[model samples]
Target: MAVPEDWMGAPPRQPVDLHTDRPHAARVYDVLLGGKTNYPADREAAEQTLAALPNAGAIARQNRAFMQRAARHLVSEAGIRQFLDIGTGIPTSPNLHEIVQATAPQARVVYADNDPIVLAHSRALHTSHPHGRTAYIQADLCRPGEILRNPALREVSDNFEAKGSHVNARSKGEVLRFFHGLDLVDPGLTVVHRWRPDTVEVGAAGWSDADIPLYAGLGRTS
Candidate 1:
């Protein structure tokens, strides 16, 4: 499963000198996902994390599975047809748009990230279904105005109608706060793997919240 060197894409139009000396969180996550786009620093950081938590890799995969499950539920059950993903990491198989558009072929998705490496691999994010559409923007969450100003994001936003929302929170309190004013889907906020797990993909250990500390929920305005 060796990818060609050119798959990362041609050089950026603007100079995006990477800070390869330091470990970036996204690249470390890429390493955890078994992706080859990370640097030695990222690998070192990932190794350190694994040393402390041996199940980190499994946890990463489970988190990804949770995303796919959530996206599928929104499309198949809630009738949502658009998505705006912020801080999207490296291009992983079965991305949000891929999962959403699979259920609703005409669904549209917009991905925004601050990492220059993600911009280099933006082509993968833009691979839309013939009927659906996808767009990627290099914007930081800290600067909300920049992402809000992008025409593609604006166009997609203008056409959106809220049917439901998916929230990922670091703490149980944060997760509860997000759903405070809304009615949660069956089985409110819970550990990511327990939300709607594919046991074939995640093994017996996935049932334990201790291995994965993230919380996920889907809710709708009542």
Candidate 2:
């Protein structure tokens, strides 16, 4: 069944429904990260947001970095081999799977998102280490019960809930509601930049508590 060495391993590509006219959150984030997978509408919306909040772009990038660091912590420190990443955005390099698999190649990840565009480009997420596995689900969180009952989400062992959708301010009590039943890991629910900061430059950047509007806490359901 082996093909000749001169043969190309993969087949040709086909057309996918990108819906170039509409703007999706994942695509809009891709545009902010300077990725090329976005459409004109996404760019326009991003530009408008940027015009209103000059710090918006920086916030997005900072959030992305925090996500990576948090995933790495889960794998390296917490020894989590399973991940259920809801609201999973467009596949960027060193994605959640990539980061976790780096330390634990047997890690399994299920990325769920509501965006059709994310579903279209999900093939990238399928690439897992030979010892690991990855899957994607197209579902909306509007139906929280359905998401909770999903087979993929049920497979996750190490649980964490940190979402990027909140651009508005949230009180600490509101944030603690997310971890009502679960036990929080050390350094519970703080600004993204302050979470186990690696270097003095980042930890001492003089970023105010209000500079970042997002709250993230790592918790376990045990």
Measured by lDDT, the strongest candidate is 1
Model 1 bad stretches (over 4 Å): 1-13, 20-22, 142-146, 160-171, 200-207
List where candidate 2 sits over 4 angstroms from the true fold.
1-16, 124-126, 148-169, 199-204
Candidate 1 per-residue lDDT, tens place, 59-123, comes to 78878888888888889988988787888888787788889888888988889898877766665
Global lDDT of each model? 0.76, 0.74
Clashing pairs in 2: none
Model 2 misses residue 93 by how many Å?
Answer: 1.6
RMSD of each predicted structure: 6.4, 6.6
C-alpha lDDT of residue 25 in model 1: 85
- For residue 3, give model 2's deviation from the true position in Å: 25
**What lDDT score is found at residue 105 in candidate 1?**
85
